[model samples]
Target chain A: MTRAFNFSAGPAALPAEVLQQAAEEMLDWHGAGMGVMEMSHRGREFMSILAQAQADLRELLAVPDNYRILFMQGGALAENAIIPMNLLGQRPDERRTADYVVTGAWSVKSQKEARRYCDVNIAASTEADKFTRLPAQAEWRLSKDPAYVHVCTNETIHGVEYFWTPDLAAAGLPDVPLVADVSSHILSRPLDVSRFGVIYGGAQKNIGPSGLTLVIVRDDLLDRSLPVCPTAFHWKTVAENDSMYNTPPTYAIYIAGLVFQWLKRRGGLAAMEAQNKAKAELLYGYLDNSGFYRTAVAKDCRSRMNVPFFLHDETLNDVFLAGARERGLLQLKGHKSVGGMRASIYNAMPLEGVTALVDYLREFERSHG
Target chain B: MTRAFNFSAGPAALPAEVLQQAAEEMLDWHGAGMGVMEMSHRGREFMSILAQAQADLRELLAVPDNYRILFMQGGALAENAIIPMNLLGQRPDERRTADYVVTGAWSVKSQKEARRYCDVNIAASTEADKFTRLPAQAEWRLSKDPAYVHVCTNETIHGVEYFWTPDLAAAGLPDVPLVADVSSHILSRPLDVSRFGVIYGGAQKNIGPSGLTLVIVRDDLLDRSLPVCPTAFHWKTVAENDSMYNTPPTYAIYIAGLVFQWLKRRGGLAAMEAQNKAKAELLYGYLDNSGFYRTAVAKDCRSRMNVPFFLHDETLNDVFLAGARERGLLQLKGHKSVGGMRASIYNAMPLEGVTALVDYLREFERSHG
Candidate 1:
């Protein structure tokens, strides 16, 4: 494999070993006499593969016995609408208010979709601060007897992350459950499952591929679907059937199962968290010391998975990208809404890739500054 | 590649040539220096690929000028919910209602999901007869001033099909438009575009892969999405953005585009329909002539793609499946609910595959009858 780093936000770089294994198995998976793509989803071979994947993922995350893991389709964006549809039935129809803490673009989108299904109150927002940082949980306006409180734990665009799941019970929100979008940083760290009601993410970033969504939802929240909620997307039906209510995204699920196996082989989430932490620190240390560049997000809230930073001199933007590309660093361009550079070092990214990027950054700054 | 016949029901066989081409281009697509999966969705390379696929599909189906083609995710199951969320806004909130004609499994599913968004009236049904035949269009009790009328043109499980679209206007009913689930039989034949307001299919069966969904919708139905519809799935937004509101199943789209190109090279839909007809005739003729086997669906309403049949004695099911598997005819097992054999002869299955199946059927009947 070439020594290139791909840093696109989602649909980002995959593990080199995983891609190699996928390529090797593309034509025939383990002498099954058919490619994984060609296997019948209901056949014994695929069913075994699906089962092992769910089991491995459960072990890796240390998921609580109370929660059910579901393999779903339509990605995380669809889940924004689906979550509210399934959970808003918790309260009496007239008292179905859901609270949201908007930290960035993804949370804003979540709140907008939630408004369609229930009464929504924005408990906290960072939009007024240009989404440079997540607001402290103490400065909030939470709704009483709300069905659920929603938060995007990792904001993909603005690069802010919640390092810890806030304790809702201690904060006078004991009755209200918390839901989080951990799309960008799901596998980068170990999570506390008992603290949250639902944890969901699109699989494209750290899991395996696009089109598959990973939802870790409590069984208690499974049955309260709105009368108008689509049955296929209703958590109750999906959880009951083990996510086989409809034909799941079979191939994507197969690939994701492979990813779970790979994660387990690499010593599970704890090992991954250590690697991710070291990589983030190395890259952030260089950026902190470099007078030529600066990160916009507050240091405490900055995402370890996504590092968005701007060069002090805007004129060096094209030159910076060109130099980076020449050195085999790819897809480092930041989102268009926030024009700068971004390096999304997800779970698949090796620490060596981060060191290489840091070395390049230091050399470039020395020459330009 | 091995010369095996694949009869998988959905996640079914693809053309051998298509798989070969994909393998060859796995690392780099059209000398673009990146795999199709790795390319940005908004990049020029993938954009051209997407546009060509859409244009060729439009041309092959003789799609009306007013219809917009959308490439979406979440399969036919998601479309069950998406269709209503996008279309139910056509009527006043208090007056919105949709009419459904439930011929089989897929129609029942669509109607069930549509109830989440609109008041549904069952226009026609074949449940009393165990879904063995299509309901006659004349007997449909269609609602006046309904938002839309929906039907599953082909039922994959029941193996029943509507050979023709119902002409609602000519039947003296209000001119409510038609929406059809053409998933199982989409490219198997030519369709009259003007007869339906919306036509959609999941790509896994006859198109290409599992993740991509195709929706051909009339232009007039573009703008009236309900307030609750998620922007990502709202047809109007996807249609306006040309299906790029979210990161699509890019590699799936590329493979589907390749399938469309292959279909065109083999002389378009007319030629395809003839080949499909021959294949279906060969299999059905053998089943009909052999007293040992029987197809339950009415002869006139049998699906050309999915042919579900049963052994007369019911004791030979295991022996039949074993013999078929030994001959490299894979995934011939029927749906669990049907407890028989289903041979899905989609567009990719060659005439020779059907001949082999027929030959095997004849030999088995001679030995066992």
Candidate 2:
């Protein structure tokens, strides 16, 4: 069977070229006589792999000099506790609150896990309107002297995204920093790295694989972790050692590095953003114009990566999915929590994949509606 | 170049056949269009991969019914902090102590990391002897009713191992649990699974790769976690969800499953133990008889996996390493902390590789002498 365009929200589609390159090097990596997986993290070969990966990621993202990119294990779900354990120490006694904006499901999980570490202050929430729109920055009621503000820049399940970083200084917490969970939509657009103190995500989505988590943290944010923070997760220790405090996920990093190289070959993030936006527009534009299919989220807040739409007659959902699967339009079923259809066209998904999905959307509506 | 004999302490040598098989399946796994990395962790394709890996590992290790196997991220280094965090809650107020035996660089790190989470009682340490000997059970001062006793059963750095589990009842700490860090030599030999409360290690050494850490812990040890323990690291949650509390390292687990199948085909751990012992003896026997070479540890306590040997003429160390490398022996240099040479003939290292290494040792000595 030929490769299909995978629409999984996470552990999502990766470029086919990267997979081929990985297969070519699976036995002997660049004449080193050992696969990347078998090379010791401390060895010269894997060291080069790690160094090149870090450099390429920094260049592609145009990441600021003050930021450190760490290749760590455990996904963003684990980082939920790690973020609080690491950042709350800045407040000294863990007495000051960490403000959270609950835009969707991902942000809700982040805040709930944080409560175990410190006092959580709900700065704002849009659940009143069913998380259909990203709450306006003006509606936020931030806590007095908070440690840090948390937000999920893009929600994987609910399909809402904050396309712009909120200006925390203007929002009254001048000294406070914004930490974002950018799991689903990291490389799909241009990000002003200076705006957020920290940006983290599991690599399963736009990155490479499930094991590796990318944490891009500001230099000032280091060395302030609570004493109870695990040494493996201590950002200061990991940053100081260059993410080598422990044995890193070498193969995952290797594959991710290949993906980074691929992204660079395709003209880096700017070009990728253009392609991703065009793909999302093709799908969303049709949904908006189509009478039988409707998107749940507001037009202003619909995620460019994960676009979930409902069929007017929901009973035909199975028939629609079967047809999509048969045509190699794979994993188009929406999350069980939000039942309908979601086409997650991440950075690796070409423009034609979305167009094919759109074609299927109209064809299925014609037959059933 | 063909695959060389990789003598790395970790991220060590893998069976060549396993690497070849992984390469073959790298693009499409069993007709699934997407590679293992791009599949949804919740999808059926990855779920089968995860389940098979767990089942194969359990069968090979003969894991007891009372135990739960957790596939986690973060190597053994992370577990140093995680073990205390997951276990300290059993003490309720973090007042009760955990006993640790500092045998080498690895165990020293385990205890130091545990201090951040709980009271650590160093039962015994061999630093005075310069890590040349393991502390005898009689010399260990068992803490009065400690939470659990921690030991590195196989220390990768200093080349030491406990061939048998220490009897807590005979040592007067009856009914206390034991946690063994078997990172370097897990599948190199057979084990009595019922003898320990938890057996955990990074997969880099003998198991598979660098990302996945296998934790086989007793069922009763679950659910007792400190309030601040990350949900992803919590044993009960991971055990309950079948290590899916967070997305497990999917690709690493897949490769590990393949290694387990390889190990099983070689007649499980017993056959591996026989082969491993022969390989160790073949190298150690040559070192013992050679006037130019010498081993540091006591004969009875010598590791069957990591064989660290020193050249009698220390000036010829660089010459020996260069000569060995020219003959396709790789990463044979000892840890920088203990500079000489270490040959780790793990499960995947056939007896012939050890024979070749011994031949190289003699060839280098003949010229240098």
What's the DockQ for every one of the candidates? 0.45, 0.84
Worst 10 residues of 2 chain A by lDDT: A88-97
Q: Give the clashing pairs for model 2.
A: A11-A204
Instruction: Report lDDT (Cα) of residue A163, candidate 2.
Output: 71
Kept native contacts, as fractions per model, are 0.28, 0.86
- Model 2, position A258: C-alpha lDDT score: 95
How accurately is candidate 2 docked according to DockQ? Answer: 0.84
The list of candidate 1 runs beyond 4 A from truth reads: A1-3, B1-3, B27-34
Model 2 off-target regions past 4 Å?
Answer: none
lDDT by residue for model 2 over B228-340, one digit each (tens)?
89999999999999999888898899899999999989999989989988888899899998999999987877898888889999888888888888888999999988889
- Cα RMSD for candidate 2? 1.2
Q: Highest lDDT, which number?
A: 2
**lDDT by residue for model 2 (A1-369), tens:** 788778988888889889888989988999998888888889889999999999999999899999999988899999999998898776666465799999888898899999989999999998887778998889889888888999998988889988767999898777788999999999887888899999999998888988999999999998778888999999999999999999999999998999999999999999998898889888888999999998889888899999988998898889898899888888888988788988898988999899888888888878887
